[model samples]
Target chain A: MFFLSPFELKGDIDSVFERDPAARSILEVLLCYPGLHALILHRFAHRLYLARIPLIPRLISHGTRFITGIEIHPGAKIGKKFFIDHGMGSVIGETTEIGDNVTMYQGVTLGGTGKHSGKRHPTLGDNVVVGANATILGPVHIGAGSRIGAGSVVVRDVPHDSTIVGVPGRVVRHKGEKTYDVSLEHGKLFDPIESLNAKLEQKMAHLENRVAELEKEKRRSA
Target chain B: MFFLSPFELKGDIDSVFERDPAARSILEVLLCYPGLHALILHRFAHRLYLARIPLIPRLISHGTRFITGIEIHPGAKIGKKFFIDHGMGSVIGETTEIGDNVTMYQGVTLGGTGKHSGKRHPTLGDNVVVGANATILGPVHIGAGSRIGAGSVVVRDVPHDSTIVGVPGRVVRHKGEKTYDVSLEHGKLFDPIESLNAKLEQKMAHLENRVAELEKEKRRSA
Candidate 1:
């Protein structure tokens, strides 16, 4: 009996189901879900972290990561109002602290510099949006209100009143855009997809070419 | 009720619980799992492929690949009695009709070749063992009673009662001291993952290095 009921998890579970057009029913996610197991473990770990169990709490987190590839370091203090989207290959490193109201996409790595110790991994101030395949490395502090672009490999500190993009991300747009408090309105993260659609498109195009070639060959045979 | 119980659906439900050294309780896996959802979706697609849903099945299979790096083509008729190791970034292509009694490692890609389109994927014969990160491409066939080496990129059709290894896999050994009925012993298919343990170890090693360097630097500073 953790603080939240397992039934309450249905809301987020429903979100996943809503996206997956293939899912037949809800009972499927409830009975045999490792995701559910992970949630329960995180809750226990979070409680242990709050109770100041110290190293053991972090150990639990690492064990979870080993099985799941979704790492949430115990030292990285996350607020209660937190949820992950399409949680695969997502790494949250130790010493990286996140504030209230943050949503991250898939393949988002909250990692450290190659050789830096003590407070490496970004100190994400409140209301931060990290795009997919984004790597935020080093001990750099990101301002409270910032949006990191997809596939960005950030190394330095990001200013609060700006939007960052590209490798070694730089501010792309921030002149007149409203500094919308991410906490006030942190909408759902993007659809948890990497390049599935693109690959399908590629295959479809390949098929089209093949069909055309086949037709040409048929004409030759004719 | 759904078609199959979550406990029975091996692909998506956290079936890891069945393994030794697994989690103590079911609650721990749900919240933090990164690959559970993908695995679940994979089970459905894999089954659909068995039912022969044609292109839609493959499309949905690609969708699973996009969401999770693990790809199991719907057209590749795989047998039961198999397991995926790490199950990340693994690709099993179309036209690869696998026999019973086979196993594969992680980062393994069973793909097709130039636009010939006649049973594009490899037909893996029975009682075969493919190592981690091995790539078996083209419509070429792999004979029954064979073992493919890890990190090998295979292109040619393998001989029966043989062992292939290396970049363009060369026969390492033939007549590997074993005698079993290839017809009766079924093949198995799943994602390769045992090879990925090195990555986890590397992460731990990198962390150790940082701590060791910090201690040395602290001594110098003092």
Candidate 2:
């Protein structure tokens, strides 16, 4: 059974202030941030779950999901300084495990591939940042100080100090120095589709050039 | 000012019942579905927006967004028999126009490309079904009876009765018969990424065979 200490709770609130520049006051954060509300509710539900209370924990989780649109299963284990920005449609699966100082954007899903049973969800290491609409599936592990780009779908393990991007996410950058900055700019990520399209266009141009050369040779022969 | 008739309201409720097999009673739908609640609130906000009531409409929309997590700008126009399933994180931008009998799933964003001014958002024709987490961006038009697959990022216009999939969505099937089935089965849709991967694998196999044949010819010549 895991418990969040009073120091951890204060750290959570303080982390929001440190991370979000728009956070003006503690009162506003307490009242306005649905992500904070959802996390606070999740703590109670997790406590109930640790006590081996089944239905009540689930009920509390359901209520929290309804209010926040961020569904965190009571069985998911999260560490300190966990922040979810604009957490609508974010789902943390039952078997998910997270380390300290993790930041997540909206529409992120830590889910299973629908084939596994126990411990199906992914485990995140410390100082990880996940971008908007990213889906990390299966029981893979994401190592410390990694950045997952927006709209990425990761199914495999990611190494430490890596930047992951694209569908069936690929590590574009690895073994870099860990920047403790957790602020994620979603629009500035790498686009795999656009890159693929550019490659295809270049291939088409090469083929066209070859065809034109062949035509000129045929004319000379004639 | 746009007004929702009693008949339209009944149609909206009836559409939910017809689409969702889990919907047992009217009471259950009224109380349970956050999508319906958001839509109901949007109607009032839209009316107030049309009447030029300053700040009140925006306040109503803000409250609705907080409660439901479905953000519909008051200036957007929507027609009858609209149904949204698991509507959390669904965002309808201002100046967006949606036609009748439109069905949408969770996390769907009808947004702009951030380059346009007026009518920046997409316009949906009648009987369009948008799958979960599908993003339709820019001022593109989705024609009547089109089906957008789950997790697709659509930036272009779609033809009538077309089935769209992939990033920067492509129409895989077109000129199809309109079934008018609002119940969208997300798992069963065609995956363009898988298809592309399969094609690449086949090409690789062919290249390998050609290389082997060339080597055999060289050995014979030697």
Candidate 3:
């Protein structure tokens, strides 16, 4: 029931190297990386689930959650070359759909908001990057080449090539420029609030000057 | 080596009921609630650590991490009635100090930033509430009754009764009024960004009106 060719296994291993800078060697990755372990077990469990086999798949998924601290429901559909970095406390719901070359960081959740039945979880398009602790809830479609910022809560459909940030996630960028970057560099992410604050500071300075000038003009007129 | 009086055990279990609204029964909490399990194990491990015992304490801590998905270094100091809700992916680093009646949500990290040894992790004062996915790094002090919002990354010392929010956590409210709230209601958290944006919107409107009045006055003067 559980089988993967050497080539396919190597592809999965290589996917880790593309996203994580800390990965040292194959031995270290095999021994230390819980994310890879979770994916491997998830793949096996997913096969069992697809075959309409009961209980064993769920047991395998539960055991995987215990071992890796990453919970992926067996019924979730995932594409090739997907990688989860750190991945502790990350959860993918039963009906969640993930696309190829997606990168998910630690504590991320692709979850359902309510008790609704079919397709309750989110759908991610190819080359989507979900940052640490980001929660994407409900059946939202995150378009290709999109990036969800760390700690953002997304509940809506995002268009292609978009960058989402803030709680109740807002699409801050829709450049349509495809991101080939597998490394979801969180440090460089655009903070909309900080930028807005800076603009406000400038406006305040300008307003102070204008007010002073107005006061002087009024005095001269009197 | 492992013993707790019935009264003490009841007190610990009662702490859960104080924080979590979903906690229906003590039996259910004992059966489930990884947070409580982790704390029980940590208390045992911490005693072993204090007795100048080595290896075994670390081993117990490591095993507890695997079982509960929460890591608490034995060297960390924790006080009474401390409750961790959900607590998956939560980490308490060595030299971390937590005061009485402290509440921590899921994915919270009390961590060190640099390699320097002494008191590397943050200290939480009594009644401090750390929301989900909040990362408090370095040897900072979180004053009593301070609330760190969900997804906040705090690196600095927070004053008593302060409410912190944002990526590089900022003190949004410094009210001296201490919070007795055990439930870290994340939905009600004051978003500094949203407030700033609202203020900006109002300012923009005021500027527009002022500019229009200035233009009219200039036309009348001409």
lDDT of 1 by residue, A90-179 (tens): 788877888755656445788987765677777887667675456788888878667775445688888874566544566654543454
- Put down candidate 3 lDDT per residue, A129-208, tens digits, no spaces: 99989977668899988899888867689998888888656788887565475336654567776788888788778777
Chain B, candidate 3: TM? 0.89
Candidate 1 TM-score, true structure as reference: 0.41
Cα-based lDDT at residue B53, candidate 3? 88
Worst 10 residues of 1 chain A by lDDT: A185-194
DockQ winner among the candidates? 3
Residue B198: error of model 3 in Å? 2.8
Which candidate ranks first by TM-score, i.e. highest?
Answer: 3
- Give the TM-score between model 2's chain B and the true chain B: 0.85
Interface RMSDs of the predictions, in order, are 22.7, 6.8, 5.7
Candidates 2 and 3 compared: the better one by lDDT is: 3
| Docking quality (DockQ) for each candidate | 0.03, 0.11, 0.15
TM agreement with the true structure for every prediction: 0.41, 0.60, 0.66
